[model samples]
Target: MAKNELHIALVGNPNSGKTSLFNALTGLNQKVGNFPGVTVDKKTGSIRLEENFDAELIDLPGTYSLYPRRADEWVAYKVLMGADADIKPDMVLLVADASNLKRNLLFCSQIIDLKIPVVMALTMTDIAAKKDIQIDINGLEAELGIPVVTVNPRKNKGLTELKKVLAQASRMNQNLHARDFMNTKKLAPESVEGVQKLFPQLSEYAAIHYLINHENFPLSDLDQKAVEQVETVNKFNPNKTQAEEILQRYTRIRQIMQQHVVEHGPLEKKMFTEKLDNILLHRTWGYVILLAVLFLLFQSIFWLAQFPMDGIEWLFTKAGGWLSTTLPQAWWSDLIVNGLVAGLSGILVFVPQIMILFGLITVLEDTGYMARISFLSDKLMRKAGLNGKSVMPMISGFACAVPAIMSARNIENKKERLLTILVTPLMSCSARLPVYTILISLVIDDKYYFGFLSVQGLVMMALYFLGTFMALIVSYVMKFFIKIKEKSFFILELPIYRAPRWKNVGITMVEKAKIFVFDAGKVIIMISLLLWFLSSHGPGNRIEKVEQKYALLAQQHPAQADSLQKPLSAEKLQNSYAGILGKAIEPVIEPLGYDWKIGIALITSFAAREVFVGTMATLYSVEETDDNSSLRQKMDAATHEDGSKVYTLPAALSLMVFYVLAMQCMSTLAVVKRETRSWKWPVFQFIYMTGLAYAMSWLTYVIFS
Candidate 1:
C-alpha cells in the first residue's frame, strides 16, 4: 500500500465519542464483523483523504490503559503492541475526551510509549468549555510532541483538519518522539533492556509490556523462556512495576496539565450530571423510575405499532385475496399466496414493533442513561449472581439474545458472564411478539382495567416481567453450580446527559429492522414453502383417496358440497406429511388443549417463534377456501373433529406461557454456539429451556382447564 493509502487504528476509552468520530469520518462506508478467532466486534471503515488518497480505519475496542483486564481490552492491547499481524496500522488516531482529559490522558500516554506514529483527535471540547475549562492545544502538542486536533464529531467539526493531520503524520519518515510523553526506561531499566536484547525490535515500553503480559502475548516457547529468565534475573515483580509506573506517569501528567491547561470554574461545584443523579440514582426512587421507564417502553412498543401492524396485515390480506381469485388455481399459486405471502406478512408485521423497541433503546444509550441503569441495577444483578455490567446485556436481551450474549464480553468474571449469556435469552425478545399478539387476541378480552389502562397492555407487561423474573431465578440457581475463582467488580462511567443525536437513533432503528427482516425472514420463508408442500402431499395416495371420496359426496349432495369442501380439505390435510408428523406428537401435547392443527404449527415454528402465526395462516388457508379472512379470524373459526373450539382460553394462555420460556429459535442456538465456542452449551441450553417450557405450559393448561 502507498503511504497515503494508510491504515489507521482508532483507539480510545469507553464513552469517549470514539465511535461518533468514526461515524463522522466514515459515514456509511463501514462494515462490522468479529476479529479473527474472537467474538469481539471488529469495525472497519474507509475514508477519502484529499480526494486522491484513501485510508482504512479500524475501530478497536475501548480500554482504559495498556494493561488489559477484559477480552475486548486485550484486543486493543494486542493490536497496539504489534502482536496482531492481521491489523497492523501505519498510524494510530487516538480519540480523547477533552472534558475528562486527566483520565483519557492515561491511555493516550500509554499508546504514545508504543513507538507508533499517532495523531490525537480531542473530542468533547464544547462540553469542557461549558464547564469553564480551557486547553492550550499548542502547549499540549509541544509538551507531548504530537499533533492535537480539537473536534466535535457530533457537530461534524474539525474533520477536514483531522484528515490533513492524519495524512501528514502517516507520511513522516522519522518516527514521532514516543518517549517524550512517558519514558518507561526510567521505571525498570534492567528488565526492559534484558527483554529488548531478546526481541531486538521492541521499544522500552513494549519490552516492559511483554514482561508483564508474556503469558498473554503471542510468543514462541524459546522467546518466552528467555523473557522469563530475564524477569527472574532482574527480580521484576509485575504488580509492583505496574503500580510504580502508573504513579510516575501521573506525576509527569500533572506537571504537563498544570502548564498547558486552565480551569476557570470552581472545582467543587456540583454539575448538572450530579444534580440529575441525585434523583435519577436515588436509593428509593431509582427503582421506581426504572420501572416507569420500562412500562413506558413496552406500552409505546405496543401502542405505536398497532396502527402500522394493522395496515400491514390489511394490505397482505387484500393481496392474498386478490391472488386467490386472480391467479390460476394451481399448486404454484397456492405456494405463492398461502406460503410466501403469508410468511412475509408474518415477519413484516412485527418490524414496526422491533424498530420501536430498538429506537427507544438507542435513545436511552445515546443519552447515557443506559449506564445509569446498569448502576441502579447493580445490587439486584448481584443477587442474581451477576454484576452491574450484566444488566446492560440483560436489558439488551429484551431486543435480541444473539447480540446480548455477545455484549457479555465486557464482563470480566467468567462465571458472571456465562450466567448472563445463559439467562439473557429468557428476557423475551421481539420475535415472540407475534405469537403473544395472536394468542392474546384470540383468548384475552381487550378491556380497560381502571378505565385508563388497557387489559392487553397489562398482560404484555406481565409477560415481560414473567420472562425477567424467570431469568433472575434461573441465574440465582445456576450461580452455585458454575464454579469460578475470579472475583467480580463493576466500574461504570456515567456520561453527561445530552440531547440524543437523531441521525444515530434513526440509523440504529433501520439497521436492526433490516437484520430482523433479512436474517430471520430467510429461514421463515424457506420453511413456509417446505411446509406448504408437506401439508399438500401425502404418502400411500391418501390425498387421492380423500379427493375421490369428496367428489362422490359432491355428486350425491350438490347442495351440501359448499359445506363439504372445508371438511374435504381438512381430511386431505390430516393425511398430508405435515399432518402425519403433528399426529405423531399429538399424544404428548394433547393435555395442553392442542389438536393436530396446532401441533403442526408447533412443529414448523421451531425455525422461529414468529413463524407460529405464519404456520397458522398457511395451514388454515390450505384447509379453508376463504382468502380474505385474517389469520386471527381463521384461527378463531377453527374446531376439533367433534366440532368443539380448539383454541380455548386455557390453550391460548398455555401457548403464550410456553413461548415465554421456550428456546424455539434455531438462530439463537447458532449464536450461542458461536459466542460460547461449543455445542455443549447450546445443546444444554435447548434441553433445559424446552423442558422448562413444557412443565410450565402443562401447569398453566391444567389450572385453566
Candidate 2:
C-alpha cells in the first residue's frame, strides 16, 4: 500500500463483460498468476491514474453474491471482504451487466453495503436496449449512493468517464456515510456486534460474513476461537441470516430499479438469441451441428495450415543446410545445426495448426456456443458419471491439462470432480497435435473426398473422437469403483450469441503460440542437447572402435566408400549411448510396432508429450545423412535393420494411440496430485493410463498390421 498508489478491485458476475473491461483498461500490462496459497488465477495490472498516483487493478474471480459457493467465489469474497492479506483494495470497480439489471444489482448492492468506495460500470446496455429495457445511469447512481457509468468495454466506450468517476470516488470520504442497501444490524445484531468487536475494521456486512465463514477467513487462532465462541453464545443461524439478507437486498433493489429502470412488455416476436437457440439447442440437430462444427474445425486445421507448415519446414531445412556447410565442421557446429535447429524445427513447424485450433476454440467461447456444448453434453456426461460442468474442463483439456484439471474445482460434487480430473487428460491436447499431424501425414494420404473433405483431416478427427470416447468409457467404469455419491444438478446460463471478437481471438492465438514456443521449447531444447551428447558418444570404446573400423574399410575399398557410408554411420549410432538406452527398453515396446528409436522418444517425451517430435528430430539428426532433410522427411525415410519401413501405417497409428491414452506428462500428473491432495491418485493415474496405452497400442498394431 504505497502512500500515493491506489488498489482498485474489479468484481463482477460471471460473463458480465468483466474480462473485456479488464483487458480494455490494462491492455498488454496484465499478468496472470495464481493467488497466494491458491490455484485460482489472480490477474493484476498497473494503470496510470494521475502523474503522481498509480493504481493496481486486481481482477478477482466472478461470483453471483457475497454468499460464496465455489472455490473461485470464495476467492472473490475473501478479497472484497478484506480477508485476503495480499490484496486490499482502496476502492472497488464493480462491473454490472446492464441487461440483467435486477440480478446484477443484487451483487452491486452487496458491495455498496460493504462501506468500500465503489464505482459501477454498466455493461451490455446494447443488449438491454435490444430487449426493450432502459436504465437511467445517473438515477441508479443516486439510488445506490455510488458513481455509475455506462461502458461498452468491447468497443472501449465510456472508459475515460469510468476512470474519471473512479478517481473522483477514490478521493471522496463518503463511503462510511453512504446509505446501506440492507440493514445488516437488524438481521443478526448480536453476531454482528460480536464479530465487529473481534475485528473493528470490518463493516457490518463484512462482519456478517465473518460470522458465516470464519473458518475460511485468515483469522488468528485466538481470533478464530473468539469468533467460534461468539457463534456458540449467540446461536447464529447463517443459513437463515443469509436468506433474510438476500430478501432485504432484493426488496431494496426492486425499489431502486422501479425508480431508475424501465422495461417493455414481452414482444410477440422472439429475441434473436432465443430464435437461434431453438435450432442450436434442438435434441437431434444440436448434436449434428456439434459434429459438423468439430469436423470443419479439424478439417480447417490441415487445409488451412499445410501451406504455412510446409514453408516453415522448408526454411528450417535450408537453415540447417547452410549452417552445416558454412560453419567449420566441428562437434559444436554439428550440435548447433543438427541438434538445436532440428529439434526446434520439429515443434515450430506446427505453430500454424496450434494457433488455428486455439483461435477456433476461442471463437466458440466468445460466441457463446461453448456453453451450449456443456448443455448438450450434460445427458451424455451424466451417463458417464459426470455432469454438464465437466464438459468445460474436458474441452479446456484440449488446450492443456494442467489448467483444465485445476478448473475441475468448480464442480461441487466430489466424485464427479475427481472423475473429471482423472479422465480429462485423455482429451487430445495441443501438445499431441504435432505427433498426430506428423503421423497422419506419414500414414494417411492428403487426398480429398467430394472435393472438400480431407482423408488426413478425417484421421485427425478420429484420433480426437477416440480419446473423448475412451475418456467417457473410463469414467463410466471407474464410477463404480470409487464409491462416493453425491447428488448433482446442472443449471447453466447460456449467454446471448454475439460475433466473435477478432482482436481477442488474435491475442489468444499469439499468446498460446508464445506459450508453446517458450514454455515447451525450453524442455525440448534441453532434451535435444542431452540426446545429442548421448547419441554422439557411447559407453566405453565402442563408438571409437566402430569409427576406426569404418575408416579402415573406406581406405581399403575407396570406390565402395560412398556405398558403405550409410551402414558405417548406422553401425556407429547403434553402439552410441542413446542407442544403448533405447535398446534397453526396445523389447517392451516392440509389440506395439515401436523400435528402439521410438523407444527413446517414449522415454524422453515423459517430460512433455510435444517432446516426442523433438526427440525424433534429435535422434534422426544424430544419424549422419548426406542431405539436409526435415524431420518429416527423415522419419518417412527411416528403416529398420532389415530395411523394413519404420513408420508404417500400423506403427504410426499405434504410436498415435499410445500418446492419446498414456500419462506422458509429468506436469499433468503433478497437477492431479495437487488437486487431489495426494500422490495415490497420480500414481494410479500413471499406472492405469500407461497400462491402457500399452494394451491398446498393442491391439492397434495387431489389428492393423
Candidate 3:
C-alpha cells in the first residue's frame, strides 16, 4: 500500500522460472499470504531494485491472458488491473521466456492494452543459447516501446540490469502514455447473442472458453460498469460481443509477434529436451519408467526412513521410562509421566520419518520429474475415466489424502476431479507407514530375504502396491456409472533439469514436518490421554482388588508370587480401565486374532497410523521386563490362556493386511471435506475404505484360524 517501498509486480506464464527468480532475489525476506478474497497464494519480498533503492517485489500467479480462465489465472489478471486491493503497483515487471517469445509475447500485449507502466524481464536465455536461438533484446525492446532486460533467474544473473530498468521506469512517471488506458469507450447497440458477431478478432480463444463454461474464472466481483457498457454494444452488434472484442486484442498482438519473432524453435527443436522427452513421454516405456520411479520412491521412504524411525522410537520409550520412575509413585506420577509426557512425546517422535520422506518428495517435484509422472499416468487414467491432471493429486494421497484430494482443482473436468477425489484416499498415505512398518517387522523380520531384499522392505512394498491396485479397480467401477467424454488435451511443459536446491528442499521439509506434527499431533495426544484414562482405571474397583489379592498372595508364598507376577500382572491390566475397553472391543476384534489390548490399539490408531507404535510402546513398558530382554522379545513371548504366543506370524499378517486397507486417518478425512467442498464424497470414501479394511482383515484372520 506504500510506495515508499515502490511495488514491482512479477508476471509470467507457467514454468517461466518466476518463482525461482523471486527466491534468488529475496531469499528468506519473503512472506507468503493470500490476495484479498482469492485462494491463490501470494509471495512478496524486498529486493534492491537498483542502487540506493529498495523495492517491494510482488510475484503474481502464472497465466496466459487477462481473460482469466482459472483461480490462478484470475489472480494474475486482477493484480495488474488494480482490482484486487489498495496496493497498486508502481511498476509492472513482466518476465517471459525468450525461447518461447511468440507464445509469451501475446500475454505482454494483453498487459499493454491494460496500459500499465511495464518493464519486461526476459528469462530462459540459457536454454535459448544452448539451442543457438538468438534474439536482439534491444531491437525487441525498441519495437515494443518498452525496456527489456535479459535474465537467468535461477543463476541470479540478471538482477542488476532488472533493478536499473525498474529505477528508470520509476523515474519516467510521465503522464499515462498508453492510448488504450482510457477504459472501454462503449460498443454500439447489439443483441446479447449477436455480440460475438460484432467482435471477429476474438473468435479463437472465446469460442473454446464459452463451450466449456470454465468455472475456475472468478466472476463474483465483476465490474458492473464494464458489464453495462458491454451489454449495450451486444444488443445492437448481434454479430459480435465484448468477449470477442477482447479476443481481437490478443489477435492483434499475435500479428505483431508473427512479424518480428523468428520461427527458429519449430525448425530446430531443442535437441536435448526433444531427445529426453522422446523416452520419458514414450507411450509404453514411459509408463514403465514412471512406475519404476514411483516404486523406488515408495521403497526409499520405507528403507531410508526406518533408521531414524527406530532411533526416535527408542528415545521416546526410554524417556517415558525415565519419567515414570523419576516421578514420585502416585496417581499424579502415572498421569503426568505415562499419560501427559508419553502422549506428547509419541506424536513428536515421528517427525524424523516425516521429514525424511517429505525431503525426498520436494526434490522430485522441483526437478520436473513429478510432472513427468503425471504425463505418463494420464493416458491410463483417462481410459479408467479420469484425467492426467488427476495423477498428481492421487500420488499426493500417498503423503496425506486430504491435500491430495484438494489438489483436484488442476483437473479441468468437474466429474473427473470428483471421481479422483473419491478414490485417492484408498491409496496408501504416509500415515499408514507406522502400521505397515510395525506389522511387517513382526511378520517378516528386518533382515533381507534371499540375500537381495529386506524381508520387511518387501512386505512394505506389497502393502503400497495393494493400496494402489485397489484404487485403480475402484476407479474403474466408478467409471461405468459416471459418464465422461475425456475430451481435454493436457498441456504439460517438461522443464530442463537443474541441480537440486537444498535450501528449497530444506524449507519444504521443515514446513511439512511442523504441519504434520501439530496438525495430527493434537488428535493423537487427545486419543492417547483418553486411552490412558480408559486403561488406567476400571469398574467395580477391579484394579484395587488385583493389588489387594497380589499383596496377600505375595506374603503367604513369596517365591510362588514372584514366579506368577507376570500372569497376575496381566490380571491387573485386564481389570484396569484399558483392560475393560480391550474386553469390550475384543469381541469385535476376536475374529482377527487380536486380544483386548490389541483391540485398544486398533481403535486408537485411527487417529493416526504412527500412533500405533507409541500406543504399543506405552502398554508394553507398563509391565516390568528382564533387563536383557528387548521389547520385541518381550512381545514375542506374550501368551494367551492356552500358552500360545499372541503375536504369531499369522496374526501379524492379519494386522498388516488390515492396516494396509483401512481408512484410519481422521485428519485426512477432514481435508477431504475441505477440498471437495461437500461431505458426500468424503463420507463415501471413508465408509468404503473402512469396510474394505474390515473385510480384508476378517478374511485373513478366518483363513489363518
lDDT of 3 at 204: 32
Model 2 bad stretches (over 4 Å)? 1-4, 173-177, 326-331, 392-418, 429-463, 481-487, 559-565, 593-597, 604-656, 665-683, 700-705
- Candidates 2 and 3, the one with greater lDDT: 2
Error of 2 at 467 (Å): 2.2
Q: How many clashes show up per model?
A: 0, 0, 28
Q: Which one wins by TM-score: 1 or 3?
A: 1
TM-score ranking of the models: 1, 2, 3
Every model's TM-score: 0.90, 0.87, 0.79
Q: Write the per-residue lDDT of candidate 3 for residues 1-705, one digit (tens) a residue.
A: 323458888888887777777777777767765566644467788887655678888888888766665667767765675545645787788888887777777677666655577888899887777766677776677567778888875677978887887887888873224344112323232322232343343233232232222233333434333334445554434235446655665565566556555446557655776777789888888888888887787678667877886787677778778887787889878887767777777666567656766687678767777678877777789787787888877777786665466557667565777788778877787777757765666556569667898777777778878887877788888878766555566777777765667776776677567666665667667766776677678888788888898889889988797666665666776787766777788878877887777876776676677666655655565343324235566667777768888888778888888787777777677656655557876688788878887788888877877
Taking the tens digit of each residue's C-alpha lDDT, what string does model 1 give over 1-705?
333378899999999998888888988777777788777888898988766788999999999999888778889999999989799898899999998899889998888888888889999998898787789999999888889999888898999999998877767763766455777887789999999889899988888899999988788999899999999999998999899989988998899889988877566578788899999999989889998997787778778988998899889989999999999989889999978998788678878877887788878988989888889889989999988889878877776675567668778787898899889989988778878887888888889967999888788779989999999999999899887778787888899998787777776677667766776677667766777788799999899999999999999999999878767776787899988999999989888888888788787776667767766765675443334337677788889899988889999888889899989877677767877888988898999888888899999999999
Cα deviation of 33 in candidate 1 (Å)? 1.0
Candidate 2 lDDT over residue span 1-705, tens digit each: 234378899999988998888878877777766687665778888776656667889999988998876668888998888888888888889999988989999998888778888888999999999888889887887778778889998888998888777777777763533578778899989999998988898889888888888899877899999999999999999999999998888888889888889987775468899999999999999999987986687677667878898899889978998998899989999999867997788568767877887788779988999889888989989999999889878876776776578668768677899999999999998779878988998889889999999999899889999999999999999999998866776767899998877777886677667656765566566666776787688989998899899899999999998877666666766788867878999988888888998987787676567767766765675443323347678898999888989999999999999999999887678678877879999999999999999999999999998
Residue 591 lDDT in model 1?
84
